[model samples]
Target: MRKKGAYQQYKDVQIKTANQGKLLLMLYQGCIKFLGLAIKCINDKDFEGANNYLQRARKVINELMSSLNMQQGGEIAENLAMLYEYMNHQLIQANIHKDTEKIKFVKKLLLQLLEAWQEIINGSNTEENIDTNLSINI
Candidate 1:
């Protein structure tokens, strides 16, 4: 196997060191980035590229959904899981149809979630508070 590049190694270390809240934030950001790329590809009439990016975003949503702790999170986790499912469906439709509007809708939802998470993580002075804010399992 080829050796990892400096940036890849750095990213690995960063992920290993990050807190749960930070990891969640990263996932949201990554999904948003992929969706943005998909939008650009759609605008350029690159259906293959858009499909690839949409698939990546869907995977991130899957990860987020899997991380949710229904037992501990109650109604909130259930709602989030449903929302994630809807987002994934939207992504699939966007991919199949090369629909930039659907991608934008999903990206908007992710941005809103990301902003809420940032507020929760930033406002917390204690790890316990962070844990409380996060409906998903660490």
Candidate 2:
């Protein structure tokens, strides 16, 4: 096996230091990356490579689903779980049929989810900035 490169080491440290919300965003980004690769592999007539990428994407979706806090997150968690399930089903069908169209559709769905997560991250950062700027005027 090859030794870890500098970039890989840096990414590891970044992930280790990231908060939960950032970690969640990373997972979504991973899903989008894998799905995009899977689509490209299909376009290249590399069904095997596509299958591997799709399976990796499915694993990320499963992780996201399993990490949901149903007890605390309630309806939002449940909704996300359902969406993840649908994506997994779509991925399985794409893998079995080696369909580029299905892969594109799933990629689109994942991209939408990633965008929403990014917006949420940005919104929280804005709120944090506002909180830090406020002074307790007695």
Candidate 3:
């Protein structure tokens, strides 16, 4: 026997869950967009632009993390957490050394991540759907 109120509550929960998933997807895509811009800035030797993009990227990562239930997110989440830390470290080192190469290396890694995400978003079964190269067309 199903209670009427319980069924309504369950329906509400389903809608909320769907909305949350959409929000997560948006956040991930936002991160990738900012990361792509950051790569462009690096390649163009625009340190200020690159730094601004990094701030945006950090915000996106924070939003993505807030959307997750840590314990339930499993290995992918764990790997992302670690990669985020590495990305932060690389950014700091680039700032300290004023090293364009460091920024390039970091941007390459981020590009790979973004391209992989795009592949998944496009319903590709693997990350190979997009070339991970960072060359600028313009």
Highest lDDT against the true fold, candidate: 1
lDDT of 2 by residue, 18-61 (tens): 76667777888898899889989988999889999999999999
If the candidates were sorted by their TM-score against the true structure, best first, what order would they fall in? Answer: 1, 2, 3
For 1-138, candidate 3 gives per-residue lDDT tens digits of 966698889866755764332334455566667767776887798878888877787776665445444465566666777776777677677655556666567667766766675455455333232112211110
Q: Compared with the true structure, what per-residue lDDT tens digits does model 1 show for residues 90-136? A: 88888888878988999999999999999999998887788788978
**68: Cα error in model 3, Å:** 3.6
TM-score of candidate 2 against the unseen true structure? 0.86
Error of 3 at 132 (Å): 25
Candidate 1, overall lDDT? Answer: 0.91
- List per-prediction Cα lDDT, in the order shown: 0.91, 0.79, 0.60
Off by over 4 Å in 2: 125-138
The list of candidate 1 runs beyond 4 A from truth reads none
Check candidate 1 and list the clashing pairs: none
Worst 10 residues of 3 by lDDT: 129-138
lDDT of 3 at 135: 13
